[model samples]
Target chain A: MMMQRRLTTLFALALLSFVAVASSPPSSRVVADSVYAIPMLTLRDQQGQLFDFASLRGKPRLVGMFYGSCQMACPLEIEYLKHLQRVVAAGSGKSISVLLVSFDPARDDLAMLRKVAGEHHVWPPAFRLARTERGDEGMLAGVLGIAYRQLPGGGFSHNVRVSLLDAQGRIVAATDASGRPAPAFLRSVDEALKNP
Target chain B: MISRQLALIPMLMLPFAGKAADYVPIPAGQFESALAIAGHAAKLRLAAFSMRSEPVTNAEFLVFVRQHPEWQRGQVPSLLAGANYLRQWQRPLEPGESVLPDQPVTQVSWFAARAYCGSEQARLPNWYEWEYVGAADATRADARRDPVRNQDLLSAIEGTSGHLPGVIGTRPANVYGVRDLNRLLWEWTGDYAAMFPNPDARVPGSVANLALCSGSALAFADKNQYALMMRVAALSALRPADTAPRVGFRCVREPKRK
Candidate 1:
């Protein structure tokens, strides 16, 4: 009788565990379902390190796209992002990660990426300069709402837009990252960090 | 009995052989594009590539959805497609009686179209490539100079509304032997986002501010090409996840080396 009772208890515990596992959402599903989440892509950073994009899921980030050869807007974009990071850190006491991906993968090789990173003084783990191995860079651009076209003179005409993603990779704020950081966007970042 | 079974083998293999999509080679060339950069007409130097002879059909998309159920109507993530995506289909896996097999598939999002192209070992053509091929007519490779031809294209676009898309290849092929570049659905390009004239500039005084210093805005070299202008306007208005009743796509690939 005791053996049968113990068997019944074991079965109930197994069923409870199965339900728990089934009910909770998987980490991949959470990332895949978010509208602002970057797709499962493997990219190489300026340091020639291969990292899955999803690895940045657990931190709030400011993401944008630019090319290394961009003479004017790209350099300013990096400066603006750095400025925003400083402001967010100073105001909220939280450091936001920055990721600037390259749309011109063919021209922006590792050396070029490294050169730009060094010029901008962007260090990894806080700021990352990266490019994809293939043509999916356009898809990333589309999701971030950045527009770019290659010009006849081998330059690019691209809009500058920056997006802020929460720890789970959900877009909390986005704005034109052309000049000084918009105060409204900074407030959104502050709110995002405060809640967590 | 064994000889009779052997005779049926060729018949069984026929459908599979016919399932492959046909691609035509577009020769490499320096072509002038309608969209301008830095206030001048952009000249594109294209490499040799092969393009699908026709837009993807409803039947073909059905096969893709079956193999990739994640792309099916209800199954697809909202990030990849809006609520209206494939809403006209009878079911997730079936195009149904209302949707014909040969009709060019519409109501597909850009992400979905890109995935379909990827599955075929191809990718969506960039806007420049699409515009380059679109400049052709049945006779001349570059026919944008002909006002009558341009007028006909405008009429075709005006007439396509409130109507289901006709079958692909029903129209005459372009000079490059590709069909349905016009007079059909508005197709998605790989670089649709890149074609925006000045999306950021629309932010009201933002352009005059620091944002405008980036030189991101584009200008049209030939504003007289109303047809191309209208297409660019329509495509620019869409987000990657948004789907339309008339928007569809075809794939392109680099020509195979001998």
Candidate 2:
């Protein structure tokens, strides 16, 4: 009788362990093709809240890289993105999340991120200005087709590139983010938003 | 006590077991880069750092992937590495017989190179650091002005195409004690894309049209620096995820901050 009782308890334990293993977070099941699979990146947003870059998964969003101290092109990039957000919303009646990561992590502290967010009137849960607190943001930039270099002077020479990613963190489209959004890029964004 | 001392033999041999340990120190200096751009100064003041004497070989990288399986071919994220990442390898964990163990590892993405460097507490050298070291020959630093040496290097580069890269250290070490910087294979710089050569810098709004800041357009300082220009061109053509059979990388270790 005791042996049977022990066997039942062991079987229950095995089933419980199996359930626990199956219920683990989906992070372990990261897709090999997704951008989030390039090692976990921890970031501190404009509001100074620490979050994993991978946590931004499960929602299609726009991503770009900029430095807070950038004078000409970066500010223009912010305005251009704002215009893009407004257009996407007016056409689809749905808001798109935007993440602007800073490539100059040495200078883009929490205060600088918050300042940039305030200067552009962009806020969290919709538009977030974040800096890398732990991992290499250069890897992130490389994946998104953004390039930056610190010039001999205090300023930086960089290209403004923004990417539209699906909920699976796959880049669906990209734009130089210069003047106006390309029609084809807009169409891709629309398709992604619709499916997401 | 004698037996206990004998048991320490394996631990002593561990440090010399891998080929990844030969790093030579490079002195800091203000060097003129060939691809100087407008608005950005051509002269770069670099700090002292240690650079790997030779590029990482296939055998060393295979060991690296074995320890870090996430970086192995077919397991790495496609966004970080392309379809050709380590395609020369026989398998994800094996380099096979055809892929020589001593040959400098090619077909590796920049991300993978950076990761391998990070494992060794180093990173890919910036372009200026690379240029400074590459300007050196066997005896003299800044040998770019030597026409004979330039022609010889140009010939070597021309001979490299459509052929397998030779083993590392085939040539004598440069003045910095570094080998294979200019000849064997093209290498990845930490900021290659930043050196994008806008075709017509004289044209107004061309820099702005590309959305590159600082009004900088890459202009070669010396027109005769064709070898260096070819290196820059090769690096500029590659995306971070893309890899070529002729491109490999060496790592640098910056001085620790106080």
Candidate 3:
């Protein structure tokens, strides 16, 4: 009977240790378990809404990066995303959130962002155009495997990348879809929305 | 006299104090870079800044990890660091026997390096800034014109390719009193990604092909400077979260206004 009581005490001590380990702070929890799960970044959208980027984890998102004054692939990138959005809605019968964060925070202010959105016919609620004040746009670009360089003429040279993030904010798939919708990328978007 | 003597005590203890970082002033100037801007060999006007005299050491990084436990090995998220981040450390907080206390801390991701610099209210130097400072020798600010100096730098790069990096500041300081810019290890720059646009982006898909074809091609102003070209190539190949055995970092700060 005494041995049985000792085992019960040991079990209780083990349980307490487990609880203590599990209750560590959120920072210790490794919130960015995947590239899409990058830590919360506060950004101002075209609509002037201060959005918490981390809060979008529960919903599937189509994410890309662009600039307001980009005269090259950025326009095609927007059109490709718009095409993907329509394809995903038709394929999965669910509208996915599309987010394009600007790399040119110096020029892509609220007025310019709003103008770009209107030109692209991207209205918020389904589409969001955002910019960061703290120069972390480079950090985001790094995470998404996008590379951009500012030219001497105030234009930029950058790669085209569109990533499909799952409901948990982990990248399901990404593609170099410039001017045309990549079939595999559209299928991945449909799959994510269907599962979510 | 007694008060002056007491003041010397604190100054003497300053090196042993917990503050491990030391900054040396780099005067701003117009310098010609090996990389061209806007399809022309334009001189860059660099801002005055202060640079760490040496790379961050293992012992110093240990103190950093202790204070910010989130950056500790195995505790850092995979998204911010690769599997080999701080893999050489003996434990989460210890640098162990394999890693010497004075050796430059390598196998650090760009994200980790940025965070470490952030802790000290500094940032990583841009590629242009790094290239400008790296142009110096022990006597001259611009040593690329000297063939002997160029050969010596090439030999140094070849000699240190396979081996572990030596202790920081073991080599002589440059003209600006900065140490280990070329002799020790390749470094992470703030604008490393901006140096080389991905080749895939130049393909004919959208207007990007026309916009970036000539300006963004892999063209270097001084192609014969193999050491500088190799550094650019090595840095451009890495992602921000990726870590390498031979890559380390130092921090830079804007000069305080008088």
Best by lDDT: 2
Model 1 CA deviation exceeding 4 Å by range: A1-23, A26-28, A31-39, B1-18, B199-218
Calculate model 2's interface RMSD in Å: 4.5
Q: At residue A173, give the lDDT of candidate 1.
A: 80
Q: Rank the candidates by lDDT, best first.
A: 2, 1, 3
* iRMSD (1 decimal) for each model: 3.9, 4.5, 4.3
Q: What is the per-residue lDDT of model 1 for residues B108-134, given as tens digits with 9 covering 90 to 100?
A: 999899989988999999888888898
Worst 10 residues of 1 chain A by lDDT: A30-39
lDDT of 2 at B4: 88
Q: What is the lDDT of residue A25 in candidate 1?
A: 72
lDDT of each: 0.80, 0.82, 0.79
Off by over 4 Å in 2: A1-28, B1-16, B39-41, B197-218, B256-258
lDDT of 3 by residue, A119-154 (tens): 999978899999985536666777887777665456
B1-258: candidate 2 lDDT, tens digit per residue: 999899998645533355546789898898888776663438878889989888888878888898899899988888888999998888898788777777889999999988888889888898888989999999998998899999998899988864557887778999989999989999888887777534332233442443332222245667677787777777776778998999889899986556
Cα lDDT tens digits, model 1, A9-29, are 999999999988887675445
Give candidate 1's error at residue B247 in angstroms: 1.0
Could you report the DockQ of all the candidates, in the order they appear? 0.42, 0.38, 0.33
Clashing pairs in 2: none
Off by over 4 Å in 3: A1-32, A36-39, B1-16, B37-42, B198-218
